[model samples]
Target: MDGVKKISLVIPCYNEEKNITRTLDGILEVFKSSSILAKYDFEVIAVDDGSKDATWAQIVEYAKKDNHIHGVRLMGNFGQSCGYQAGFDASTGEYVITVSADLEIPLENLAKVVELLEQGYDFVNTNRKNRWGGEKKAKSGMANKIISRVSGVCMQDRGSGMKGFSRVLVDNLKFYGDMHRFIPDYLTVYRAKMTEFDVEFKDRDFGVSAYKGSQVFWFYRSSYYRLWFLGNCVSYCAKTVGVQYWG
Candidate 1:
């Protein structure tokens, strides 16, 4: 908070036409109203992961109006990891933040993540408060809980899409396949400082979820997701070892 710093928000979108406008509005409103804006300049980089709908159109239109709002359109649906990688590669901020495109996680919590980073935490993650709202939600939470317990990271919400980290942390990150799910654990492997804050979660009222069930479920459904489940397992095991050694 000494000098004016920049915060780059990387949002990955895939056919989120119904929610994209709200997502953009939410972030812009934060910058306009939050006290953080007094000390930090912010940019929202939305990556359109080959959205079949009008998601890209919205991004383009918004970007033209506000130079701080940027857009990255992938050649094809490269999954969230690739989308994030694209945004990260293009980001020019000292602190980088990533969130879901669904707008399920309120945009207001983003200011808290940046606040923690300012307090010297290298990585800040969030936990879903209303996690018991649905069976699928419960199952996903259970899966992530198992992963966190087995990996020994203990954040309990490794899969949370809302996260904040420094540029150094982002540079050290290696994203591939569906490895974004274990982001908190990956930061642990790199010996980065991490903390978590609680935030309310909501169900998507617009678009459908891309990953419905098991990892392998997508392989049979689309070629873009083939072997993603296997890749996820490999990344999980490899990063877990790294955590055990460094942590």
Candidate 2:
């Protein structure tokens, strides 16, 4: 806590030109107000996931003007999970926090996440009390329930855009498909200590959500795959136990 090195904040952008500056400003404001700017070094890594618009250009301009801002442009669209992975791979920090580019998740909650980690949580996730409104909220709540039941993890929000993990946890992660949504569950299975905290959520100020009805089918398919994986893991463990008992 006294001599903490730099903290890296990774923002994965896909057509977020309209909200990038506002999000960056909010993060900077949080740091300034918390006096984190004075005590610890921090930097922002914005990954432009092959956005077709001016998202990459804006990030490049900001990075050029500010030494603390770094931008990475992918060759093609690789979805949000891969974008975050790219940023994570590029980050060199004592701690890493992944945030949305829509500015929906407040940067202020990051302080609480850092506090939890410093207190010994290997991974931390955001639990949003309010996520958008109306139909969106209903859908999110239902999806979260399904994910929690299937994964056997008690998470209020599965796809929350604000999550933090220590350097060790991040370094140990292995992602495939839409596995980012199951990070907490995966970490728990691997014996990583984790915690969750309430985080402020705001409505998206720009750009429509990319998630579609078709994606829902893929999500369910992925869930089934996860079930198969879990079954195989359990079978293997059972066999190991049986072998030990017999031998």
Candidate 3:
């Protein structure tokens, strides 16, 4: 170990009261058994995105027990982008990782991302293998296919909950509505060195997905958020290419 490699992990929670404690325990267990722990120091920044449940209470409880854990409670549900932004802004590490509070992606898989980061990759993306089964898989498959076709990005799962990147990549990111879901695309536009790997998956143990059909329908009904996402992408591309394209 050349030096202590500091890593900051940020997780966004919304109504994940049932799973947050287990998720945090799993992460700490992973770190305890990890071969890289001797070289790495870690902190967990969990942002409660105004969950309507006991999510914030759980976060505060865990933070009190562990100094390495920090909790941020938002005044209202400002969406995942805002939650991620809060965590990102609070992060102070050479490498930062993002994961969902659902704990769908197994904790041990994070070591591979750390290895890739140490190998000089700016961003390490992951695909959750065997994420769903039967009908759910069928639905996700169709939806993902449509999303890929529309986005023109061929990542098997671009919206995977786990991601690892260096501080430099975080500096380049500007999180907005649904922008976290398109992180790989954004990093590609910036020409950041990247790689992808598969990770173990588990079904979400508690709480329903925040984005239900009715909620999604209503979200798209108001074109403001959609436009905000598109505008950011256009602005990024224009700035990177040094062109005035968004006018």
Candidate 4:
């Protein structure tokens, strides 16, 4: 491999047949124009989480044409965490990233993530640069702030979908239920090195968003304390139980 690192982007799709191919092309274009990211090879792992549409068929067609593309299909609707788990299980790269299949966040901002990883950060996250001035956006923003404060993982956007993780971090972490939404907070349990930045958000031109807006926060609100407690336990055990140290 000539010492070159590989980055795998994991995108979870739920009825995103219209957007999947375009999303992959956008990432490829961003990589080609990026001098910083050119040194590394990249692969895409697209998981079709029981889409009623032809999402899986689109993934299969693209994969046949591009060797870097890998597709996995679930027998039934299993939510985002499970979709991500499927992708993670199939990934074979030094760095793994989770991105929205609808391209809500610009793919070009990926250069920032690669730079941060190269500089020694084990995880990287990005928040939208501007607020869209809507009731739902305001509500989700407020809700995320509360969620982050309660978990002591306060970043600008804890629920941000696009994030990067080192292979080491990915190996040590697992997602269950809708816990993927709280990855940054949970990473604190493993004591992973992390960083965050702002990436411009774009209006979707394809079908409407798959997410349920601010209501999406409801999936993990009850689990916030559970995660907080788990993080504390890890820290406590590190001092007394001589537990495995992730840092």
Where is model 2 poorest over a 10-residue stretch in terms of lDDT? 238-247
Over 4 Å off, model 1: 1-3, 134-138, 212-247
lDDT of 3: 0.74
Error of 1 at 20 (Å): 0.9
- Kindly indicate the candidate among 2 and 3 with the higher lDDT: 3
Candidate 2 root-mean-square deviation in Å: 9.3
Per-residue accuracy of model 1 over 128-243 as CA lDDT, tens digit each:
77655466556656666565555556675655679898999776665776667666665666677889989997878897876653442233233323222333443442121110
Candidate No. with top TM-score: 4
Least accurate 10 contiguous residues by lDDT in model 1: 238-247
Residue pair clashes in candidate 2: none
User: Model 2 over residues 40-100: C-alpha lDDT tens digits?
Assistant: 6788999887788998778877777777788877777767767777777778888899888
**Candidate 4 per-residue lDDT over residues 172-235, each given as its tens digit:** 6667665677777778887788889988887777788756555755644545666655544333
What are the per-residue Cα lDDT tens digits for candidate 3 across 180-223?
65666556566778888988877787877765333433332433
Q: Estimate each model's TM-score.
A: 0.82, 0.84, 0.81, 0.87
Query: Positional deviation of 216 in candidate 2, in angstroms?
Result: 5.2
Q: What is the lDDT of residue 152 in candidate 2?
A: 74
Model 3 ranges off by over 4 Å: 134-139, 142-152, 211-247
CA-RMSD of model 1: 7.9
In order, the Cα lDDT scores of the candidates are 0.74, 0.73, 0.74, 0.77
In TM-score terms, candidate 3 sits at 0.81
